[model samples]
Target: MTLRNIKSVQKTLGLLLTVFSSTMLTPIVIALIYQESTSLVFLASFLITGLFGLVLWLPAKKADTEIRLHEGFIIVASFWVVLALFGALPFFLLPELGLSVTNAVFESTSGLTTTGATILTGLDELPRSLLFYRQ
Candidate 1:
């Protein structure tokens, strides 16, 4: 992609980041409604990552709709990478969230890719809220 195309892609990324962040709020809201302690972890993560995602979306306001395949790839990959990076923040904050960086990324990718695997064990002891998260 040309420099112009790349610029456009960056803008779209910012917009997507904004959207991704908004959606993340739902889980946080759910946690709070039930007065679950997990809400604290979710709140911290929500504020940090949501603000970061807003930063990603800033350029999009002026971006053009036309974008090349190369630019599209860059945008999509960056979004997912940023997602996984920010996604890891929550796991670190809430270890009971039960995922390492590798495991989290693998599961995220696996779910998107539909790659079935077996590794997660002991669903019984996990709290109801966390179990809902697993689903």
Candidate 2:
């Protein structure tokens, strides 16, 4: 693949990441409504993810938009991996949740992929924000 194609992928991934970062707002809102302490965590996650996305996009903004077939696949894969990591941020940030990195990643991946598998127990006892995020 040419450098141009790589840049295209980078630009696309950046934009996608920024969009994905905004999804953090849903959980933030849930936290607000439920008066859960996790609001700060979710808001922090949103900012961090969004800024990282903006950093990626800003440098690649001048790159051409056209993407090759391979670049498309690469972008898709990258989206899943990056998004899963960011999606795990809230769980990782929550000290009381007691989630290890592996469990957090698995939980986020499962939620993102809709696998319906979770390591969490006592779902009913968890805060609304966490429940909403997992949903």
Candidate 3:
């Protein structure tokens, strides 16, 4: 509840965000090897997510504190939400999928949460990199 603890959570989330952004790179590599044309989408997603992470991290990183349990829960939830949004970027950007932002969010959330539910159809026709990320 203290300002320091909150700062710790922010710092942790920021670091986590940066780390999470790196996950996008794998799909980028996949796109490169497979020539899926979605490489740029993954790259853009990586840069945007990385920048967002730094924006959240750099300001609060100087706090130099440990995260408390309550703050840990908050951080976990915040990270999941932010991660889902970031995860949906490629789906939203890809023209072939024809996914709205809302549908993209639903897909990303479902994948990340392992809910096995999605609004997407024709997965067999989707790009491999996208499918790999969802899987």
Against the true structure, whose lDDT is highest? 2
Q: By TM-score, who's the top model here?
A: 2
- Residue 14's lDDT within candidate 3 is 85
Order of models, best lDDT first:
2, 3, 1
TM-score of 3: 0.92
For model 3, the superposed segments whose C-alpha errors exceed 4 Å read: none
Return the TM-score for each candidate structure. 0.73, 0.96, 0.92
Q: List model 3 lDDT by residue over 7-122, tens digit each.
A: 89889888888998998899999999999899998899889989989998999989866766788789888888888998898889888888999999999999988999989889
Per-residue lDDT tens digits for candidate 1, residues 35-108, read 66776776677687767666655755566778768887887888878765655454456677567778766654
Pick the winner on lDDT between candidates 1 and 3.
3
Q: What is the lDDT of residue 107 in candidate 2?
A: 94
What ordering of candidates by TM-score runs from best to worst?
2, 3, 1
